[model samples]
Target: MAVAAVTTKRKRTTARPTKTQPTTNAKLIKQPLPAGLPREWYETHNRRLKAMRLAIALLDTGIYHPANASNRRIRTAAERIGIHPPSETTCRMVRSLIHYAD
Candidate 1:
């Protein structure tokens, strides 16, 4: 007597595709100011005034605090004179002015 040969078949499996969902809620993060100022200030003096205003705000808010009181007063004077005070990182940029003497 001869036994019949048995055959077995293996099944192939395929990976299922992944599904992605869009995010509905996301928070925006504050970023640093761009490299240059806005174009509204065509005159150099106007740009300087704007810079002075920003510097004053920064100083008042303690963003650039720990600075010497004398330096702060100097910066305030510069703001009043339409001369934008230099940034804290470049405080040396401010120029000195002298009145005419007889």
Candidate 2:
């Protein structure tokens, strides 16, 4: 008696295509500042600068009491200079300017 052999073929699996975000290949170049943007940037810089200057003045004037006093003064001065609710970056700079007497 001869036995019959059965062979099964395996199916091949194909990888699914992945979605990709569209991207630009052009080199990035900074465009010239618009007429209004430079002035706005300068004004912002001026306000932050004024805040720093006032903080420095406070330090120089011997008003480092409670530490926060100078910080508050800095905030107030910033507002007085037309900057409302000063940025944390500017405030941090002001805080860093403080010096303590040994």
Candidate 3:
């Protein structure tokens, strides 16, 4: 009696998706804030901008959940993005942004 050999197919593996950087060289021009604005207004505006930046940085680093964005993590992300360490208020803002992003 002759026996037939059985063949098995191997499973294919796919690589995990990696974050991609912008290929364009687009740059943003820093226009000075409108003249005669109140100091508090300027401060608030700058703080909001910083929070947005930190949030984006954290997202890019694979931090999609707000729970993952601790004060230390947010501050570290700010430092990595060349910004000063964020205040507690700013950290909360960043987490809020991450949370609402979904």
- What would the per-residue lDDT of candidate 2 be over residues 1-102, giving only the tens digit for each residue? 233334555666965443342235645555564575667697766666755676665566565643564556767765655656556666665665554321
lDDT of 3 by residue, 1-102 (tens): 233334555676955443443334645546688999889999889899999999999999999999999999999898888999999999999999999996
lDDT minimum window of 10 residues, candidate 1: 93-102
**lDDT, candidate 2, at 43:** 70
Clashes of each: 0, 0, 0
The stretch of ten residues in a row with the least summed lDDT in candidate 3 is 15-24
Better of 2 and 3 by TM-score: 3
Global lDDT of model 3: 0.87
Candidate 1: segments with Cα more than 4 A from true spot: 1-42, 65-102
- Top candidate (TM-score): 3
Clash pairs, model 2 backbone: none
Q: What would the TM-score be for candidate 3 when compared with the true structure?
A: 0.71
* Local distance difference test values of all predictions, in order: 0.45, 0.59, 0.87
| Superposed Cα deviation of residue 60, candidate 3 (Å) | 0.5
Which stretches in model 3 have alpha-carbon errors above 4 Å? 1-26
